[model samples]
Structures are given as structure tokens and as C-alpha cells.
Target: MKHIRNFCIIAHIDHGKSTLADRLLEYTNTITQREAQEQLLDNMDLERERGITIKSHAIQMNYKYNGEDYVLNLIDTPGHVDFSYEVSRSIAACEGALLIVDASQGIQAQTISNLYLALEHDLTIIPILNKMDLPGAMPEEVKDQIIDLIGCERDEIIPASGKTGMGVYDILAAIIERVAAPVGDPQAPLQALIFDSVFNPFRGIIAYFKVVNGEIRKNDKVKFVATAKEYFADEVGILKLQPSPRDVVKTGDVGYIISGIKEAREVKVGDTITHTARPCSEAIQGFEEVKPMVFAGIYPVDTEDFEELREAMHKLQLNDASIVFEPESSAALGFGFRCGFLGMLHMEIIQERLEREFDMTVITTVPNVSYKAYTTKGDEIIVNNPSELPDPSKLDFVEEPYIKANIITKSEYVGPVMSLCIQKRGVIVNQHYLTSDRVELVFEMPMGEIVFDFYDKLKTISKGYASFDYHQIGYKQSDLVKMDIMLNGEQVDALSSLIHRSNAYEFGKKICEKLRELIPRQQFDIAIQASIGAKIIARENVRALRKDVTAKCYGGDISRKRKLLEKQKKGKKRMRQVGNVEIPQSAFMAVLKLD
Candidate 1:
């Protein structure tokens, strides 16, 4: 048998994890010069459009190094924080990980977060300082930071330009030497965690797995270790790691099988596809289900396409397990789906995908952070829809989620950035000066505040010198209230919130204005009121339709207006069916958009 190196490439968003994978494929002659492309591992159109890795994609490559054929199982992972759970599962399938860092940018907050997760998994760590060909390439600086943070030996930091293919072979040699061989057996009951899988129109369900203790072959009756369900695999093959797809994987390696199982939901990443002769017991101990931290209501722009919108949601959710949905009926957007995600980036990625992949125009509510509230009855509150908040008097206690954030930046902006965090209800937990001009600050802040524009605000305040990482910490008791939006004297259940007393006005103003913008011009004047317990704080008017859209039908014009109104009524039917208007997700933007 030839040598095997099983590993996953990990880095922060845009740190060039996929770029390096492309270079590795080219260096191994796995792909022809013409076939090798930019960011080869990013297979999804949405991933290509957004310039971020959303799903973990795995492929195999046949490479010859030191006169030995090596099977390189390359797993490319999602870099954004929202998909960290998926990334962690991807990392578990591997025996080693390539810690790709930006040479000029040095180590970032996400770099640290992902690296620590890799270490905790006990995966052999190989640090590859990528982008050495950039304008301000500082290999040594990045190397030092890797050592300080990751604590890998100095030589393990392979400085390479994944873009220019510089030091490609050196990194390959390091891969062969540094990454440990898989200790999984090909003889025990077939036990492997399904890292990721996708559907093929021609081949049916392609189930990918990392065989831990047994063997699988064509025609073998296989059962999921978790489900203990058996199926027949018509075809078995390994995916040649390339820009395109090929088949044929093997024992003690990463690959996929064309099983007769047609249901895509049956084969999930954390599910184990095993040999029926001797099925393994559990999948993996920490196969976490990722709940989306951000949420938006998705509806079609042209009301007539409501069914198309739900169909699009189903399609998007097929590949993205993180997206959660429920039947949401709003005043503006009728019969649409309320979708949730890990964070803002994750939400944008889904929205962009819905439009690009499905070829549909969408009216999306802005993304919002999930909140938990408490009522005066001492009952624990699970508040996802802002429409659920009770009257202020009915609520005695409420709190927003908090996060432990780590910010790494140049020392010059440390003081300013620190002040900004404090202003956002952040308490400084710790601080460390990494270098003479660089510092790392850890803060415990309300996730509510950090979930907003603070990311952009930090970049602006620090002049692009700062990087940040945050994950959920426990929730804390916060002095907050439920602000509600009443359209034409009727409370729009979906347009309420639990907000800090000090920050409530800003949210009230922003959301009230958003409703005004979304309510659309009407036939009669509409009152848009934002209030707290019947005390109106702000109001706006969406004037009635002065024309009643009654232009002469020069050429089906009257038919068009009637058709539009009929369609609008049909769309309005999705709304409460009582008011002159509906609260489509757009109106939910106040709840979704900022935080």
C-alpha cells in the first residue's frame, strides 16, 4: 500500500485555505494545468459569489512524493464563526490540520479560535503561513505569532504563498513528514464518520466517510452507525481532489459511495456509514447541531412567487443544515419562511444563495440576534420571534445574550478600540501586548451590541488594524424592555423586541423608520407607531394610494393594475387578512437587520 496523509485545511475567512488546496492539487499533478482553478475547493456557486467558505467540502488526491504514491484526503472547511461546529466536525475526520495564516496579516482572532479547536481535537498541527507573496509579506512576524499563540515548533511554520505556488512542494514535504498516518483499521466493523455528502443527479446519494475500524466495498450492506440502518452501495469510488468531481475512495481514507439511498437527509455529515456485518455504536461524541444565531424572513419580491420562495428555502436548507425554518405568516410578507443562521455573515450568505441559485428575487428581513426573555410569572422565556414579547408590566426580568470577544490589533488603536467596547456594554476581561505595536484584548460584552455594526465600526476606528473573534458566553441579567410596533392601532406581533433601556430609543427609531420604509404607499393613510406598553414613542405615515392605480388601460394597463392588486391581495392573503397591509419580513427587518 502507498502512504496516506489525512488532513483538513483551516483558516479564517479569506485567509486562503481553499487557495492553498488548489495549489496542492496542481503541485501533485492531480489536475491538468487547465483544470486547476482558483479556490478549487469552493464548489458551491454561493460560496464562489460571497467569497467565503460556507460548507466543508472533501476530496481525495493521488500524489507521488519521494517516489511513493500518497493518498491525500483534503478537507476544505467553512471559515466563518457561525459554521464553526461544522468546521469542528470536519477537523475530527482528519488526523492533522494545516493552520494557514496570512503572512502579511499575521495571526488573526479567528486563526486563534480555529487553531485552539484543532489542538483540542489532538490533531497534529502543521502551521503554514500563507500569502507570503503579498505586498507586505512578513513571514517571520506571522511565524512568531504562530509560535506564541499555537506553540508549534518554529520549523513547523511553513511559510508559503498559496497564491503564487511558492513553497508548494516544501509544504507538501512537510505534509508527508509532519502529518501522521491514519491509525484506522480496515479489518474491524466498518466504522466511519460521514464528514460530508452531496446528491448527484446521475449517481444518487454520495455518502462520504472516514473509515475508522472496518472496510467497505461495492455491494456491501452498510448501515449508519448511528441509525443501524443498512443499505446496498451500487458504486464505490474516491473523489480526486480537483476543481471538478471524480470517484473512487478506499479503506483508511476519505471518499464517497453511490448508495441506492436516495434521501439526502438520510446521509448527514455526522452520521456514520458503516459495514452492516459489524456496525459501530455511536457517531462521534461532539457532533453538535449548529443553531443559527441570526434570522431573517424570506419572501418573494413579486408576491406571485410565494411558493417559489418556500421551494427555494427547501433547496437552500438541503445543503445548509445550519439554516432553521418555520412557517411564518406576516402582515407584509404572507406565507414566507422565518430562517435562522449562526451569524450575520451566515445570513447574508443564505440570502445571496437564495437569489443566485434559485434565480428568484427575494425580500429578506435584515438579520437579528436571538434573544431569551423572562416573564413576571417566573417562567423561562424562549423568545425567537420578536412578536412574542408581553406587555412591559407583564415582564419583570429580561436579558440579552453575551459573548466573550477577543480582539487582536495594532497597539496604536488599542485605547480607542477598548473605549468603543466599553461603550457597547463590554467589560474588559484581560489584555496582552503581543508585540511592541500589537495587542490582544479580551472582553465580555452583550452579544446584542457586538452582533450589529461593531465589526465594521471596529475596522473603521482601528483603520483596518484590528481583528476580532467572539463566541457565546452565558446570558446576564440586563435592564431591558419590550418595544412594540403598532401599525394602524393593531400590534404587529412580529415587530417587538427585548432591548436595553439605554439603547431602546435607537432600536425603536431604527425599526420604526424601517417599518415606514417597508409599509409601502397605501390607498388611505397608514399610521406606523412604535410604542412600549401603549406609550407611543414615534410615528410615521405611509400615505394612501392617491391614484388608486387607476390609469387608463391603454394596452392592458388596467388589467395590469388589477392583476397586480389581485396578486397583492393574494400576497395580502398571506398577511393577517384583517389590515390594509401585511407585515412581510421587510417590516421584520428591525428585528432582523441590526442585531
Candidate 2:
């Protein structure tokens, strides 16, 4: 156990964490030259194509130092803010974190936020200046930023390049020397912390955990403390590139267990696993529950697939525990689930994964943040969907969730970035310089304002130099209204959104215009109106496809043409009454891109 080191790599997006992990794997011989690849831990194809790590991956490696073999369990964590929940779970299972900072970029928003998370867990932090091979690398300047941020000594910060495998050996040595090994009694009752789990069609669920106390062996009758379910350990093993079965996984080790628990909900992440006969006294207190910042309704394209969709979500939840959902039905979209996501990116990734992994075709409604609505009857209700909001007459007020947004960018782009935040109804909280060239801007913004296009707009305005991170900061009372889109006098609940009263009109106007372009022209005119209760703010119409009955009578008398036109007009009116418009899948997505 003394030679065992468990640590995870933490950094902002594209800071070379996975690249560094690859080099570490090579030095430790975790994977051979034939199997080497970029982002080897990011198993999802979506992750590789997008050049981002969507989930935290754990793998065990063996390294020889001072002529002694050492066991190193490295968890490669996602750098995006949307996946911070994954980072927290990874942190809970490790004793140390490798804080990688891009030398040219210095310290960004996520770098600071993830550092705070690691510090809160009291994990040993090893600061590494990555991308040293780049021409713009500034080791000394970034070292100063690192020192000011973490208050570590100058020499303690290692300068390394993930591309060239520089300083890989030094990082390995630091982990053995600085990181504290797991310290728990092997003879005590088994207390293993399940940090992550996945579903396998053939073998059931595989739970990855760290043995904090005692040992778990193959064929042992184990019990999950949270669920209080007992099952025989069908397989017990350490996680390498693949699952390597073993007779036993002892204390201070990270490994996986397969217990033939077919149901995805049976094995919960953060639950403790112990022997059924000699269970631990208490369950491990893992990280706090995930707080989803965005809510959206996801319905199957075909209504009959609702059951299959639910099953897929359960299996997905086993892998990504951050997602929270409840059964919901929409008038327009039919039976579906209201899923809470960390952010837009998280929502997109989940939707894509459902399509690719589960082969579930789904229609996602407009994404909105959760709100607290206080009714005149003195009842406080949590409204995740605009359709759930109380009637305006009975509603006293609505409070929207707010976030403390931290944005780090080059000093020159501060003006544009500040203006962008202000346009999003954001209040300036503070602004400070991290270095001579880098500035950090803090703002208090309503979560609803940024749900649509704030991230994209910020990236565009800053030319992709700014890094943004935010956390929920409770709720604040705001003058808000529920804007509903009505197609021919019928409200589509899926397109309804709660918006600030000040921006509601313009936003509604934009949506109306966008739907006008996206909705195809029907035989009868389609009336697309954006309304707040009885008051319609904006309206657009998709013109009917004219048959031109007059075109057939080229030389007919004026009275004869008028008679034909009148008959056609009455026929159109009758069709409008019975013809229900079909909204294209793109129209639902179009609401999200009305910039």
C-alpha cells in the first residue's frame, strides 16, 4: 500500500491533461506502441471528434521506481465545466491531483475553479506547466501565476510538454514522493467507495471503486450499502485498458466489481460496497448531489419508443450520474422525460449519445433553467418548465436562478467581454488582473439569460480566447413572463419559455420569425404567434401554397373568375379549421439558434 499512488489529472479544457496521461501511460507501459492513440481514455467517438473529454476515465498502471514496483491509479477527468460533477467524483476517489496549466494560456476560469475543488477535498496538488514545446510557452510567467494561485514554491512547479513527453519521468517521481498512499486498516470491515459504474449487456453493471478498508475477493457475497441489495461478486478486478480479473482487490487499490446486478439503478455511484455477512458500520459520504443548471424535455420521435427511451436513460445514468430526470408528458410532444443537465454541452452530448449508443431517436425541447414561482396563495413551487408556471393572475412573482460567472481572457478583450455580459442582463461583480496580460472578470448573471447563446457569443466576440466558468448562486426575484408559441391559436407547451419581461418581446419576435422560416408552407396558412397569456407580442405567417384555380381559366369572364376565387377562399378556410400543422424536428432546434 505504501507504494500505491492514486491521483487524477485536472485542468481547463484543452490544457493537455489527456495528452499528459498518454505519456504517463507510455512511461509506465500501461499501453504498448501498437495501441497508442490520442485521448486514449476518451472512449466515446463523440469525445474524440469534438476534441474534448466528456467523462472521467480510470485506469491502473504499474511503474518501477528505485528498483521497486509501484501501483499507480490515474483518473483522467474532463476539463469542461459541464462535466465538473465527474471531476468531483474522481477527486473523492483519489489522494492527489495533477493540476495541469497551459503555459501560453496561463491560469483560466476552470483552472481556478477545479483547483478550488481539489483544494476543498484536501488533495495534494502537483502544478505542471504544460505545452512547453509551443513557441508561445511562458514557463516563468505561468510559474508566477501558479505560485500566486496555489502558493506553491517555484521549483515545485514542473515544466513539461505533453506533446514531446518532456518531464514525464519527473511527474511520475513526484506522485510517488508527494502523494499520500491510502491509509486504512485491511483487517477492518470492507468499505469500498464506488466512484463510477457502467452497464454491460452481457455481464450486468460494472462498478469501479477504491477499497478504503478491508479487502473484497472474487465470489464474495457483497452488499451495496445505499441500496441494501446483496449479490455475489461474479468478478473482481483492477481496471487497466481492460478489466483484468483477480482473486482479490485489497485495501488502497482501485478496481471494479461485477456482481450480476442487471439493473442499472441497482449500482449507484458513491455507494459503499461491503460483505453481506460483515457489512461496514456506515456508508461513505461521497460528493454532494449534482445541481443541474438547465432543464429540457426529451421525447421520442416515435411515441411508442418511450419505454425504450426510459431504459436507455437508466443505463446512461449509470455511466453519467450527473443527469437527473423524471417522467413527464407534453401536449405537443407526447410522453417524454424532463431531464436536468449541467449545461448546454452536457445536454447535447447526452442527446448524441442516446442516438449513437442507445439508437434512440429523440426530440429535445427548448432548454431552460429552473425557476422558483411564488403563488398568490402563498405557495412556493419549483417550475422547471414554463408550462408548469402558475397562472399570471394567481402568481405573485417568479425568481430565476442566478450564477456567479468567472471569465478569464486576455486583457485587451475585457471591454468586449464585459459588454457581452451586460447585454445578457449580467451585473458586474468584480474585475481583476491575474497577470500583466490576463484579466479575470466576475459577474452575477441570471442563469436563464445564458442558457441559449451566451457561451457561443462570448467565444465569438473574444475570438475564442476567453474561458468561462460559473456556479449557481441561489435565486433572485425578477420581472419575468412566460412566452408561449401558438400555432393557429393552439399553444405548443414544448416551445414555451420563462423570460425576463424586459427582453420577452424581442425574444418572442425573434422566435416567431425563426419559426416562420423553418415551418414549411402548408395548403392552408400557418399562423405562428408568440404570446404572453392573451397578449400576442409577435406574429408571423407561412403563406399557403396557392393552387391558382384562376390559372386554368385564362380567358374567362371577370365574374366567372371572381366566382372561382371566392369558392377557393372558402375551401381554404375549411381546410385551415381541420388541418393541424406538423412541426419539423429542425423547428424545435431552431428556437435555440435565434440569435
Candidate 3:
């Protein structure tokens, strides 16, 4: 058995964890410079574009140091709190963690959140201060800050910039010296936690796991604990987190096994994968069911392409297991899926992918928070759609999901960021300086505020230095009520929402503008009114279309007119056909536009 060193890179978003992982891979010569794609661990294009790690990626590399060949298994983890459970699951598979902190931004709320999770897991933390070469760099100050946070000696800090490759070798050396090897008997029972799974049509389902105990080779029969099924490994191979796949891996190794299993849902995350002969005695904890907080309905602009939408979602789920979907039917929107996601970015990514990847126009409903409400009959109603909310008198109690947001920024921009937070009904919970010049502020804010452009406003106010993160604390009671938008005396299901008392007017006006821009000029004047129960707070109108069915086609345009009618007919299929006007799928999507 080789000496195992497994550690996860934990940090806040945009803190260079993925970059650090890339440098480490390059440091060990596991991946050539040509293969050193930026954001090496972010396998998704969306992840690379956003400069965030959305999923956990793992790779193994060998480094010869001090006359010994040390094998390192590095797990790259998502830093966002929406995926905190994923971080924990990823951390569960390792014995140590390399906590990456940006030198300029100091430690953020997400950093603290992840750091606490690692400590609770009893994982050895090798702190690495990243982005040291950036302007306004303060490695020394943040190094002390990291030491104070981890309660370790000052020398425990690894000062390095993942971008520059400086001190990367030293960071690797520290991992070997400080982090403990994987603990389990190689000769005992074979059991491991499936941290990740991927699909290859020919290979079926390939499960990647850390072999904590025992050993399994080719033809070893294994059972998925969650699915209660057994299968023999058709193939087993070690992964290097590069484009090339290696042949074999044993104890203390991160690799994958193909068991000829085809079902993707059966191979679930956090499931115990064990050898059938000698099963694991202890089941791993921390496999909490992940719940997506934000909900949106996704539909094809062309109704006949509904089948195409379903296929696109299936392909997307193969790579991203976090997205949840269920069939939804609407009188106006035809058939769609009520999709659930981690947050706003997640929702936007999905919508963008459907449009870009599937080559189909998609309409998405406004993001929403799932809440538990009660009707006057005392029946419990789980309100996922704002349209589902009862009238003010019918509602017994209403609450919203509260998020504990932590913001890290320079000292100069704290006041403006706090002002924005306060405007969004955010209550300042605590504040502390990460360093003498860098500050970390914690606040209790509604997820609704964050569902908007809070991150953008934070960075704008703080001059791009402020980093923000949020985690669901719990649901809190509030005087918030739904303000439904009605067009022509009929509620536009997509344009209804629950808003706080103070900012209801502003939110209503924003939605009104979106509707006016989206709902094309109608044949008859269409009134877009935003209201609170019986009170119309905001109103706008879609003026009648000046002309429609205009014959712009030439004499040979008979076929051209047919094509136009076919396209318009396809578009009209998604319309509600309320009376004389046709509202396109774009109108439903207007509710989702933050701009």
C-alpha cells in the first residue's frame, strides 16, 4: 500500500481553491502545462465562467520529497454555503483539508463556515494563504489571521499564491508532514464513501470513492448500501483528475469502479459502497439529504419542443445531480418542469444552459422560496409558488427562509454594504476584523434579498473587494404577504410574490416594468397591475399592437408566409389565449429577469 495523503481545498468563492489545486497538480507533474486548464477542477463550463467550484473534483499525483515518493489525493470542493453539505460530504472522504484563504480579502463568512465543518470532522487542516501576488496583498497579516482562526502556530500557515505557483512545493511538503494518512485496514473489509459519480454511455455508471478500509480488485463483488443491490466490478481504475485515466489503484487511493450499473439514481452521493464479502461495520455519517431552496418553472417557448426540454434536463442531470425537477402543467404555459436549485446563480445557470446547450428558447418563472403555510381550515400547505399562497385572511402564519450571510471586504466599504443590507431587511448580527484592515461582517438576511443582485451591489459598493456568502439559518416569522399581479382581472401566476412591508412598492414597480417589457403590445390594451390582496399598488399597460399579420413577404412569399405562420403558431401555442391577445413565453420569463 502506498502512503496516502487526502485533503480537500476549502475556501470561499473566488478564493483560488481551484487555482491552488491546479498549481498543486502542476507541481507534481501530474498534468503537463498544456493540460493545466484554468480552473482545473471545475469540469463544467459554467463553473469556469463563473470562476467558482460547483462540484467536488479529485485527483492523485506522486511527488518525490525527502527521498520518498508520496502520493497525494487532492479533493477540490465548492466553497458556497448552498453546497455546504457537499463540502461536508467531500470532507468526509478525506483525512485532512487545505484551507485556502485569499491574501487580500482575508477570511470570508464561507471560509469560517467551511473551517468550522472541517474542525468538527477532526480533519487536519493545512492552511494555505492564496493570491499573494495580487495588488494590496497582505500575506503576513492574513497568515496571522489564519493562525488565530485555526489556533495553530504561525509557521503552520502556508503562504502562497495558487496563481503564481510560489510556495506551492512547500505547501505540498507540509501536507505530507502534517496531514495524517488514510486510516483503515487494507486487509480488512472493503468499504468506501461514494463522493462522486459520472456517466459514460458505454461504461454505464462509474462511481468514484475513497477506499477507507480493505481492498477490492477486478471482479470483486460490491453492493451499494442505499440501493441494496450487488454487482461485480467490470473494471476498476485509478483517476489522476486529468484527461488521461490510469490503470489500477488500491488502498488509500481515489479512483473509480465500473460495475455495469446503468441507473444513475441508484448510485447516489453519500452512499456506502462496500465489498460484498466483508462489508463495513460502521456507516459514514453526514449524508444529509440535500434540499434545493429556489424553485423555477422551465418551459420551451415552442410547445412541441417539450420533449426536447425533457431530454436536455436528463443530460444535464447526468453531470449535475443537485438540480431537481418534476413535471409541471400550467394553463397558460402548457407543460414544464418545476425545477429546484441551490440559489439564484444555480437557477440562472440552468436557464442559460437550456437555451444555449439545447438550442431551444426557455422561459423561467421568478425564483421562489418554498414555505410552510396554513389555510383557515388548519390544513398545512407547502407553498412553493407565490400563486399558491392564500389570501391574507386565509393565511394563518407566514414565514421566510432566513440566511446567515457573512461578508468580507476592505474596511473602507463597510458602511455602504451595511446600508444595502439594512435596506433589504438585513439585521447586523456581528462584525469582526479579519485583519487590521480587512473586516468580516455577519448579518441575518432574507434569502429574497440575496436572490436578487445583492452580490453585485456588494462588490460595486466595496469596489470589487467585498466577498459574500450565505447559509440557510432557519425560517423566521414575518409580516410579509404576497402581492399578486393581475392582468385583465386574471392573476398572472408568474408575476406574484411575497414581499416585506417596507419594500413592497419598489419590488412591485420592478416587476411591473419587467412585465411591460415582456408582454408585447397586445391587440387590446392589457393592464398589468401589481396588488396586495385588494389593493393595487403598481400599474402598467401594454398598448394595443399597432399592426399584426402585416404582409411583408413578396410575391414568391407564399411559402415565406407559411413559414412565418408556422413560427407564430408555434409561439402562440405557449400563449394562454385568455381572450383576443396572445402572450408569449417571454412574458412568463420577464419575472425572472433581475436586470
Candidate 4:
């Protein structure tokens, strides 16, 4: 057990977490030269193209240090705030973490938050200064920032360049000397925490877990404590570059288990796996369940594909456990599932994955956050969709979810950043200077405000120098109203949203204008209106396609031309009554671009 050191890499976005992992793998001789590539741990094509880690990857490595062999279990984690849940699960299975900071960029918001997560788990942190090979690298400035943040000594922080492989050996030496090995009794009942899992069409669901006690052998009959389902371990193996099957995976080791379980729900992440005959006294305490930050509806383009969509979602959920969904139906979109996501980026990635991986074409509604609606009778209802909110006559008040936002940026952009937050109905809670030029501003802002374009605008305003992170701070009462978009006289429930009263009129106006441009002009005029209950806040009209009815009467009498015009007008009116405007898919997505 002393020879096994389990640890993970945590950092802000684009701070070289995967690059550093590649160097570590190369130095430990875990992957041969032919197997190495950039962001080697990131196997997803989406991850490589976007230059970010969307999922946590686990791999085992063998190293020889001080003439003694050592086994290292490394899990690489994503840095985006939307995927913090991934980082938490990775941290739960490790004893230590490598906190990598970009020397050129100094400390950012995600770096601080990820560090706090590791500290909360009581994991030993080894700070490393990455990107030292860059020309603008400020090793001393970044070193001091790390010292002040984590309260570690100056020399303890290692300055390494991931690109050139500098200080790679030093990082390996630190992991071996500093990270403690897993501590568990081999005789104790089997208890393993399932951190992640993936589905296979040919095989079955493959679950990756870390053994907390005892051992799991091939062909052992095991049961999941959460589900109470039993299955025979058809295959057991340790994770190498590829899964290497083993007869036994003992205590303090991480490995995969395959029992030919075809169902995705049978193996849940964070569930405990134990021997069916001699199960552990209780299930192991795992990470908390993920709370999605955004709620949206996903319906199949073809209604008959609903069941296939459900199965695809189940399999996708096994891979990305952060997704939460339940069946729902809408008047305009028909049957669909109300899905919860971490943020806008996370939601977009899931939408793309659904189309690409499962070949499921889906239509997503406007994303919103869950709201608390209290009624006159003092009954509180949790509303995830605007259509679910009670009428204003019966409602007492509405509360929206708020978050404590942390933003780190250069001192000069403080003014613009503060103004942007305040414009979004945010209140500055506190402000502190992290360094002479780097400022950290804390604000309490409604979660709904940032669901749309706040992140993009912040990046643009700060010129991509600022980093932002946030966590939910519960709900607060606000003057919010439900706004619905009306095509003709009918309301499109899928486009409804709960928005603050102050910005309702302007937001409605923008949506009306955007839809006018996207909605094609038919033979009949289309009335695009945004309303709050009985009041119309904004309205626009897509003019009807005019016909040259008087072309044959070019030299006719004025009465003849007028009669022909009148006849055409009557036909258009009749057409308007029976015509059904088909709201294009682009119109649904246009709501998100009404900047």
C-alpha cells in the first residue's frame, strides 16, 4: 500500500493540466513515444478541438524512484466552472492534488475555487508554476500569489514548463515523496466508490472505482449498495493506457469492473460496490449529488423518436452524470424531457453530444433556472418552467436563485466589470486586492442573469484577461414576471421565461425584433407579440407577401383597380385566419442571441 500514490491535477481553464499530465506520463515511462500526444488523457474529439477537458480521465503509471518501484494513479480533471462537479468527484478519489497555475496569467478565479475544493477534502496540495517557457512568464509574481493563497513556503512551489518538459522529474519526485498512499485494511469487507462509468455497445457498462477496503476478484458476485442489484464480475482490471485485466484488484488500488450489465441505471456513479456475500457494514460516503444550474426542455425533432431519445439520454447520463432530466410535454413542442445543466457551455456541449454521438436530432427550449413561487395560501412551489408558475392573482411572491460570483482581473478593468455586474442587478458584497495589479471582486448576483450572455460579455469587456467563478447562494425574493411570446393569438409556452420586472419590457422588445427578422414572410402577416399576462409589452409584425393583383388592369379605371386590391386584401385576411405559422428552429435559437 505504501508504494501506491493516488493524486489528481486541478487548475483553471487552459492552465496546462493535460499538457502537464502528458509530460508526467512521458517521464514515468507510462506511455511510449509513439503513444504520446497533446492532451493525451483527453480522448474526446470535442475536448481536443475546443482545447478543454470536458471529462475526468484516470490512468495508472509505474515509476522507479530511489531504486524502488512505485505505482501512481493519476486522474486529470476539467477546469471550467461548468464542470466543477467533475473536479469534485476526481478529488474525492485522490489523496493529493497538483495545483497548476499559469505563470504568465497569474492566479484566476477558477484556480482559487478549485484550490478551495481540494482543501475542503483535506488533500495535500503541491503547487506548480506552469507555462514558464512563455516569454511573459512571471515566476516570482505568480509564486507570491500562490504563497498568499495557500500559505505555503516560497521554495515549496515548483517552477515548471510543460511545453519543454522542464522540471518534469521534480514533479514526479514530489508526488512520490509528498503524496501519501491509500490506507485501507485488506481483510475488511469490500467497499469501492464508483467515481465514473461509460457505456459500450458490444460489452456493457464499464464502471471505474477506487477500492477502499478488501479486494475485488474476477468472477466475484458483487452488489451495489445504492441499487441493491447483484451481478457477477465478468471482468476486473487495472486502468493503464488501455484497461489491463487482472485476476484481483486489492485495497488502495483503482480499477474497472464489468459484469455484463447492459443497463446504465444499474451502475450509478458515487454508488458503493461490495461483495454480495460479505457486504460492508454500510455504504461508503461519496461526493454530493450534482445540482444543475440551468433548466431547459429537449424534445426530439420527430415525435416518434421519444423512446429512442430516452434511451440515448440514459446512456449519455452514464457518461456525463451531471445531467438531470425528467419527462415533460409542451403544447407547442409536444412530448419532451426537461433537462438540467450546469451552465450555458455545459448545456451546449450536451446538445451537441446528443446530435453527434446518439444521432438524435433534438430541439432545445430557452434555458431558465428554477424559481420559488409562493401563493396567497402560503404554499411554496418550486417552478422549473415558466408555464408551471401560478397566475399572478394567486401568487404571493417569486424568488430567484442567486450566486456569489468571484471575478479576478487586472486593476484597470474593475470599473467596467463592476458596471456590468450592477447592470445585471448584482450587488457588490466585497472587494479585495490579491496583488498590486490583480483585483478580486466579489458580488451577489442572480443566477438567471448570468445564464445567457454574462460570461461572454465579461470576457469581451475584460479583453479575455479576467476569470470568473461562482456558486449558488440560495434564493432571494425579487419582482419577477413571466413573459410569453405570442405568435398570432396563441402563446408559445416553450419560449416563456421568468424575468425581472425591471428588464421585462426591454427584453421583450429585443425578442420581438429578433423574431420578426427570422420568421419568414408568408402570404399572411404574422403578429409577433411579447406579453406579461394581459398586458402586451412589445409587438412586431412580419408584413405579408404582397401580390401584383392589378398588373392586368394597368390602364383600367380607378374603381377597377380598387376592386382588385380589395379582393386581394380579403383573400389575405382569410388566409391569415387559417394559416399556421411554422416557427423555424432558428427562431427558437434566436432568443439566445438577442444581445
lDDT of 4 by residue, 1-595 (tens): 9999999999989999999999999998999899988899999889988999999999999999999999999999998888989999999899999999999998876787788899998999999999999999999989988998899999999999899999999999999999989999999999999999999898899999999999999999999999999999999999999999999999999999999999888988999999999999999898887877667899998999999999999999999999999998877777999998877789889988899899999999997878999999999999988988998999999999999999998899999999999999999999999889889999999999987778868877987657777899899999999999999988989899999999999999999999999999999999999999999999999999998988888775799999999999999999999999988878877788688
Model 2 clash pairs?
none
Better of 3 and 4 by lDDT: 4
C-alpha lDDT (0 to 100) for residue 317 of candidate 3: 72
- Per-residue lDDT tens digits for candidate 3, residues 1-595, read 5477888889987888888888888889998877778887787777777777777887888899899988888888998666666688778888899888899989776787788788888999888878888998898889877876888888778789877789998998899888898877778778777887777768787888888777768787888887889999777877775433444456777778888877666777777778787788866653556667667778787789998888778766755667889887665668888887866667777777777666878878776667777777888787777767777787888778899998888788889989999988899999999888789999998887676556656756876567676789988878777888788778766657777878788878888888787776754567888888899999987876443453787688477777887776555444435555456666665566555
Model 1: how far is 473 from its true place, Å?
8.8
The alpha-carbon deviation from the true structure for residue 451 of candidate 3, after best TM-score superposition, in angstroms, is: 6.4
lDDT of 1 by residue, 1-595 (tens): 2388888988877789888888888887777887777777777877787777888888777778878888888888977766776688788888889988888777765676688788888998888888888889887777887888767689777778877888889888887888888886665667777766665557666666677666667787888756556788777766665323334345577767777766555666677776676666655553666655555667676777887777666555556667788866556456677776666667667777777777887776544455677778888776655666555677877777889999989888988999999989899999999888879999999876765567767866976557777788887888877677777787765556556788877777777777777867754567888787767888887765544434544575466777766765565344434556666544554455544
- Per-residue lDDT of model 2, residues 206-283, tens digit only: 999999999999999999998899999989999999899999999999999998888888978999999999989998
CA lDDT for candidate 2: 0.92
Listed in order, each prediction's TM-score against the native is 0.77, 0.86, 0.77, 0.85
Give the winner by lDDT: 2 or 3: 2
Q: How badly does each model clash, as a count of residue pairs?
A: 26, 0, 0, 0
The stretch of ten residues in a row with the least summed lDDT in candidate 1 is 241-250
Which ten residues in a row are the worst by lDDT in model 3?
241-250
Full-model lDDT for every candidate: 0.73, 0.92, 0.78, 0.92
